[model samples]
Target: MKTKKYTLLLILASLFVGCEDYLDKIDNIEALTELDIFTDVNLAEDYLDAGYTYLITETTAKSNQPDILSGLVMSDEGYPGRYNNSVQERYQSYANGDYLFLMDLNLGVQQRDTPNLAVRYSESWKGIRVVNTFLENVDLIENADEETINGLVGQAYFLRAFYYHLLTKRHGGVIYLTENLDLNSDLARVRESYESNLENILIDLEQAIDLLPVNWTAGNIGRPTKGAAMALKSRVTLFAASPLANTNNDPQKWVDAATAASDLINYASQNGLYQLIDASDAINLDVGHGGADLFVSEPEKLNNYRKVFVGPGKSKVLPQEAIFMEVNDNTIGNGGLVPLPRTYLTSGYDIVKGNFNPMNIGATANFVEKFETKNGLAIEDDPSYNDQEPFINRDPRFYNAILYDGVPWIVTDSAPLNTSGVADLAVINENGVLGVDLHDPTSPANQLWRVRNSTGYRIRKWVPNGFFLRNCCNAEEDFYVNNMIFRMSEIYLNYAEAANEAYGPAGKAPGQSLSSLDAVNVIRNRVGMPNVNGMYTGSTSTLRERIRNERAIEFCFEAMRYDDIRRWKIAHLEENKKVEFLEMRWQGGVSAIYPTGFSFENVEQVNLKKTFIEKNYWWPIPSSELEAVPDFGQTDNW
Candidate 1:
């Protein structure tokens, strides 16, 4: 018999090899020939390995990894500091009525249309094709037993559902393809209705949930578990039931979304598999006591939230908050990467604090103010929130997530200093005053000033401390911080929002035991924040606003802000809002105001107003796909 042109095993092997590491797993699989994939259990399992590569990590302009940074830049949460570059240009074009086809702006997809522009970020047809192909032939595997087969099949279904979710979320409704397409098959297909699209996705997720295990063994740490399937379902349903998608305002849809979220929460709680990683509990374990501190230089750290971002060791590897994460080495270039703050710290000419690149982008004034005070009141509302010392006594998350002036950078003349250590403080007299010489802007000791940069504050979340310049890809100490996708905390918030919408603020859905307020409190109590039930005794509308704000703070850099505002149908107002900044001018040298001696007199205003049309509720369908299927109509207002 003449050998088949391309064997399924060989095809899968080549595909797996080409995949973006997929947590460095494919390399471990034994090499097998075309027939070996079907006859060998390990090789057959490797067939499903490539599907994991479709997931996104950190967001960079050229890489288009698509995580917290992209979402922040797109929404009112933060501003894109990449002025005039592709990252800045793409965002500007999206906002200012620029044609979607003309601009290349996909946040997560790996495919590249051109060299620099990743136009296919939202496009998942190729990924779906790979998944469909696996499903079509997986049954032929002779060596894999029922359990192995079920695991692979379940993952394929979950990935297919995820890819479809990515597509539908971006372009509203997309053409759903269940079976893999052939060479001679017709490419013509029209977009489905939003409701129908979600229904089909839900069906796939249910199947995945039924087949997937609660957790995987050693070799398969990052594989989609039963929780992941349910988490995706909950998130997908949450969006489907949102105001933008649910045009009819269906109460049942909200119930469905809430129920979906509650399913995972209930299961996790009952099984004792996952819970909110409490600060007190993490501290009790003494996981993050010493070594190096991200925030304050105390021996016993109290912030579990900050520990969730940067704690070391295998025991602390995957926090309970992580339901699903994109596994990559943070130290490696472009793999599990976060923007280093040192690269951004440029206050003077010879102050080469970091290895390469100057830190440009930072936390916008509006984003910084979004965090509630320690007393759980808005900064403006909190009487103790000193305008002079705006950074002090603010939300713990603010200190952990943002790097403002007076917040120490990891560089000093005597020793390598950081926020955790009290050696050096960032003195921003960037206005260049003559008499006030303590850590002056012009002086060599104080180059860590905000006047040298565009956005006054720098991003602190997911960045390592105590290092002046870690190479972009060098990855010191082989430290890898994976970008978390779905976590228990998000599910808690999802339940809070969805249940509140379905029933009322304090009310619970038909089958649920916890009220919306209770759901919000579950997350807040873990972080030692005041509960919503105790603070806000307002109506459902007021609670709804509070729930939205909670989501903003919790999921800040995780990339949910852009979608949350859009789904809430308040994008037009939020996206068009001005980017605000707090300007700190010296009052009368450092001695007059003492420690808190600065003027909040100047609230710098920048007009970052983008053209937000009603049609902008959904991103435009890419023109390349449009040309391929001429019958497929473009999204509204494109």
Candidate 2:
């Protein structure tokens, strides 16, 4: 097992994964060999620590990255940067490869060419390699006991599954690895078929389930447990056997997926993992999550929700539902990595009365409206719905997952105001201004709550305000969040999809399972919405549609939207704005200019009926990977 006490000399030797020119090779600070990193426990710990780096590194996802990649879709209207020609043209399905990574949340757009697959792919692979190394040599831990070795092994398997899951969503058919690599295999790992790759990922997950222990102790809460592994197995199986993964539109695959998802839900209560919390009483804005102390404070259940992310009252970045999370252990003394909150954790933590932020930095309105109503109906199809009442008392998951206007949310212990730059009893709004209305605590912050005839609503998903303080720093502004790679809620969603697909939605198998409706209805009831009934039985086609929308709203901003869309083969047909790359350069004057038009052609227009073909289902293989081997073929549409 890699200890946290390895020497710096050995730690520097593991960088041979990539080489450099003579000058850079001799002076490169990143160059490290296995011997350099594995010579001691600290170095060994560093080898396995790559997982933490990927999960916590905020570098690739700072500022608007999450918003652009996950939020900005065709849902919201009048969002910024949606007026350009390419975005203007492809309002439906925009997969412009040229603008790969240009993500700006406030601006409401990103260039499709702005993506950087190479760097991300490399980062993910690095974590996987570390995990592999740990799994292989964990028995060598002379310092720690056998139970410690078991725990370390479980963590490695969890990491491999988690990293592979990321790659599966990013680029389906990613190569799967099991054992630690030799020098040659690390450099030229063989790719596997999409089906084979997914199967192998599940295999890793099963092993993880057996190896992990449930209900970990203090200092180990964020680590993987048996429940986590089981939950993930359900998630991966649901995807592989779904409309997108199977692609052949097979029903049996859907059944398998549903069964897998159900397994996790079946075990939820036993694990003390997560549960719904009723907040019908917390509207006073004084009691947080309907709990004691601060009004908007996170209740125990809500705390479980926040356990995966770093925030208030939590010292070690532990999330309640985090099966496999990272540790931003600021308590780790000077040798630890925390300069300040600005760079250490970019989304500066502010503990005001407001329990959560409802800003739609990723503003996709139509997409957000996909959740089912209390009666398991959707705003888009509710028979009794008017535009104004489309979202009324729809479902409880809606509130837990997001913030809606007029819905009771949390405020601060006291209104804070900042006469100068310093915060005091008078609270400054998120806009960095003084109290806009001392008389009105419920009034929306002017910057985010701009009214369109006093009726327009935005989103507040991740922003939670309370008695919290953040120390951001540029050195590692990247915060580590325990990605919810698996959860009980997902099991329900997966069951809905796979059940409908396998049983033809009318079959009694899944419909007869009260857990199907019960699972989702539990979520709906939490939002004070009526349960979806009558339609839960018989005829799977429409029910499938309902679940699809549920996922869209439920999993938004969790980095699963694109993956879901691709699997369903619906991206092209999606009536949202197409991404464009205009090289938005300042004309050195008062305006901006398109130094170039969008780099891709045939951008799809939104709300228009055009078929997004199956070939567009998978992302194009990286050109560099193709260059690595003469035979590797890039997916079509590159």
> Alpha carbon lDDT of residue 104, candidate 1?
39
- Alpha carbon lDDT of residue 347, candidate 2? 23
Clashes of 2: 88
Residue-level lDDT of model 1, residues 494-535, one tens digit each, is 999999988888787666788888998777667666776444
Q: What is the overall TM-score of model 1 with all chains considered together? A: 0.80
Q: Cα-based RMSD of the predictions, in order?
A: 6.9, 11.6
The CA lDDT at 632 in model 2 is 45
Highest TM-score: give the candidate number. Answer: 1
Question: For model 2, how does the per-residue alpha-carbon lDDT over 384-442 read when each residue is reduced to its tens digit?
Answer: 54343333444444444443322333332233232232211112233443222222234
Residue-pair clash count for candidate 1: 7
lDDT of each: 0.60, 0.46
Clashing residue pairs in candidate 1 are 68-557, 106-121, 331-475, 333-473, 343-358, 343-359, 344-359
